[model samples]
Target: MTVEYTDCITLSEETAELAEKELRENEATRRHGLQQVRDWIVKNPRIVHCRDDENFLLRFLRAKKFSAPMAEEALERYLLLRQSWAAAFNNMDCTLPNMKHLIDAGYLFAAPGRDKYGRRWIIARPGVFDPHKFTNEDMCRIHGLVYETLLEDSESQVRGFVHFADGAGVSFPHITLFTPKEAVRIVKNGERTLPMRHKQVYGINVHPSLKYVLDFGLSLISDKIRKRVKIYSSMEEASDEIDTNMLPKEYGGVIPMSEMIEKFKEELMAMRAKLLSHDEMKVRLEMFSEGARVGSVTALKQGSALTCGGRTLDTTLCGSFRKLEVD
Candidate 1:
């Protein structure tokens, strides 16, 4: 017995029809709308090279409910945000040394089963969160793994993400590793960049000692997120909201965390090459195109450098799309 997610962010029949029409290019609106966005990106000197994949364009459109200009706004900000946090989001190397530590921590995983609405469940238990073992960059890198792999599905995007956050045994030490600044960055990225809908966030096993910390951290996020946040007072209360049968063994579920981790690892290994291919498509100063201007898109800004964690990132329009290396 569990509490059903009342507010699953679902794609309506009308939305499905619209997505089919616009994303598939079967209708005039898709062509006109996508072309307009492509034109905008080409004109903007800030945008170096644009990957105009029909599916990519369609994602931004679905994110904004098929509003062309709005999708453009979302896409532009997404690109800029990706550029700004390149250290946290770039180069596509998942075999890094820290990845093992991240996996061993066992803080986050995609549940093997889906909910009644077909929403993918992502569980994060910060009780095992060790800042000494991993930096925020590693967190973001693993987050990229989750983002680029698990939530990349169109059906899941349409159905939405069912988030479960367990704060049991999560003391001040665990929460502090994730700073307010980092919190804000994650919140902003989720709001502005990611093209997926958040169905609901179920907060379980939160003890009283950690209440203030949790509330304070949540305060830094948006009202949209706050509204979706449902803090359960106890395990029974949480079980009222979440299906225990679909959960891992630690949380009184059928599967084990170790099994889930193995499954995720296998999926990551299979996607390794495709992830590398994304390197060229993602925004980078090294891959910008100077002469690929299509229409009136001509607002080029001088190159700028950003330093984060002692690493400097430079961004400028180079020449054009370089050959994508897909291994």
Candidate 2:
């Protein structure tokens, strides 16, 4: 289930009116009062209920005549409380109020469940909020927390783990609507290089909706892969090709002499189509080799073929005796 930041921050009219009264009295007191309100709401036995309309909470908060700073502070506290609530609900079993209040207001769906111990839980699926309303970074954090919550609460539900393909973006499992930055970190750190093992649990299954969001999020990140990086369609394919030197220097792949020469040629071609003079080419080629004569093309060619350089290149073309103008 997904909850928007705005939805989480919504305040009931009673709470809002109380907050407004505090704001009117004193500025410092108002900020503290708002924080107290958030703490109270989280500690309260009842989940906040909205009467009349779903936006009743939002309206109540808006009606408050707080100074801009106070309003912002209150809003910040409200958001923090909501985040805390989400974290708590995900990690621990707690009595949740009737979700129908949120459903009636059009904020979420009521897909409820129970843990192995028969403790009740509710999944908060998002309502009609615009997807673009939140930044990707924000979505990533939210998804991370949500995933952690689901994992802690329903340990039995996680069925298996899967490796993300090279250049493939993955979201945290459990929640399907947002991409997880942790996924990105795992890939970048080469954690996805090997198959990840997941414990088979009774109730765990990947959410279909989360898969959709992950696919989109992955597309966004994959699009950023440089032309130099090769993206594999699947983990199997990536594994088959990946080697200690599979990644680029930027990613810690040890560039071989052959790859360096090819890169040099590509760069040279971009600079000018004409072939480099024998001496000049030898000098540049030596940059990828050990100590060698700068003026001798024959030595460069022979050295390149001998080393093989951990990369597959057709050195024969550069090795042909006819091409070398041996003095």
**Segments in model 1 whose C-alpha atoms lie over 4 Å from true places:** 1-32, 281-327
Error of 1 at 10 (Å): 17
lDDT of every predicted structure (CA atoms): 0.63, 0.29
Give the per-residue lDDT digits (tens) of candidate 2, residues 1-327.
Answer: 322223243333443343345334233543444444344334322223212221222222332343332232233223222333233222211112322122232221112232233222222223322244433333333333323233222111211121122222223432433335434432321211111112111111224545565454445332323222343444344545433233323223455333433442332234232211111111123123221111111211222332324644343432221111222
Q: Name the best candidate (by lDDT).
A: 1
Report per-prediction Cα RMSD to one decimal: 9.9, 29.9
- In candidate 1, which residue pairs clash? 3-240, 3-241, 43-297, 43-298, 45-299, 289-319, 289-320, 290-319
lDDT by residue for model 1 (1-327), tens: 221111232354644554565344234655666676777667554556666765566567766666666676567556655666667776545577776656656777688757777778888876776767667777777777676676445556556687888877677666666666567556656765677777788888898987787777678656887899999887777786678876778777888889987887776777777666665554443433322111112222223333334454442332221121211
